[model samples]
Target: MKNAIVTGGGGGLGKSICTELSKNGYAVAVLDLKIKDAQRTSEGLENASAYAVDVRDHSSVIEFYKNYGKAPELIVNNAGIARFNKLLDQKIKDFEDVIQTNLIGSFIFASEGVRLMIKEAKKGSIINITSIHSVSPGIGVGAYSPAKAGLASLTKLMALEWGEFGIRVNAIAPGFIDSGMSKPFFENPKIRELRGKAVPLQRLGTSEDIAKTVLYLSSDAASYVNANEIIVDGGVIHSVLMHLPRE
Candidate 1:
């Protein structure tokens, strides 16, 4: 069985990715900071197990991989956190914390995962979960935008460097997904409606929406595809000009 690891696999898009991967016949390791949350996501899935890991801590990540026993053929860098505050109000520590978790954390996991894959002589896929904010900066999200943007760049760099090893690295930038850290805000009807209308598809994205794309990228269907960022935003990025007032 192919092994797959998903960081931040406790809930939202992470959970959905785990489910989809499991369905596709992968034995998934659901890694999250909270063991209970990871267990919750792993409960009903076949061949799925939970592990507690803080991606920012290299030791923690390495320990989890040691215990995993199986070298993963697929690694999803989906763990991240958001700090919403204007640049003036944001603390230096908070900004650093965001980068630590979202950007550097991904670096740690990818490095470790690739090491294992190379050692095992496996051709693997590494998928990083970036965001539309990485392309278009969002207000009050001072740290998130730059962190994801850096992650996107790192995705391409990893792909370029790892291609010789038969490893493919890519990213998925989700927009207005009704999951993860954004769930509660989308629960507000007014905001949900407004956001839905703004999307060209006339609806907000779901965790499954992102998961399907992840499945595709990780499969052999994309064997030759690499160093690309697939934006799963229902055309929101390209439709932004439609919102402007016209004469």
Candidate 2:
């Protein structure tokens, strides 16, 4: 049977990705920092196991792979944190925290996951959940943009270098999703309505939207798709001017 590993699998969007993979017959390792949340996510799912893992900690990840017993067919680097503060005003520790979890954490997992794939003779998928902020900078999101941007670049480098091992590396940049870390930002109805309408699709994205994309990149259909970062932001990146006061 196939297996998959998902970081931050306990969160709202992570749960959706785990559910989709589980539904598709993959025995999923739902790794989260919170063990209870991981267990909650793994419960009622077929062949799923919950594990507490800090994606930023190399030792923690090593222990997980050792205990779990093998490499997975796919790995999703979805563990991240957002520290919203102007670059100049933010504390250095807060900035470092975001970079450590969002960027370095991904590096640790992606590299180790690839090593396992090569060792086990498995061709797999590595999906990094980057943000639109990676390309278009957002206000008050300290270090997030740089971290994601770095992740996107790292995706290309992985594809370039890991292709020899038959592994595919890609990134998915989700737009204004109404779930997970972005959920709280939408609690104010005005902000929600304003952001929703700004999308060319006239709505915000859902966890399912990102989950389906994850499945696609993991499947054989995307066998030839690699080294690419697909943007699933409902045309928001291209609609910057459309939302302006225009005739």
Q: Rate the local accuracy (lDDT) of all candidates.
A: 0.95, 0.93
- Tens-digit lDDT string for candidate 2 (69-90): 8877899999989999997899
Query: In model 2, which residue pairs have backbone atoms overlapping below 3 Å?
Result: none
Candidate 1 per-residue lDDT, tens place, 105-188, comes to: 999999998998888966899999999998999999979999999999999999999999999999999999999899998889
Residue 38 lDDT, candidate 2, scale 0-100: 90
What's model 1's overall lDDT?
A: 0.95
- Lowest lDDT sum, 10 consecutive residues, model 2, at 238-247
Q: Per-prediction TM-score, please?
A: 0.98, 0.98
* Candidate 2 accuracy as TM-score: 0.98
Most accurate candidate by lDDT: 1
Compared with the true structure, model 1 gives a TM-score of: 0.98
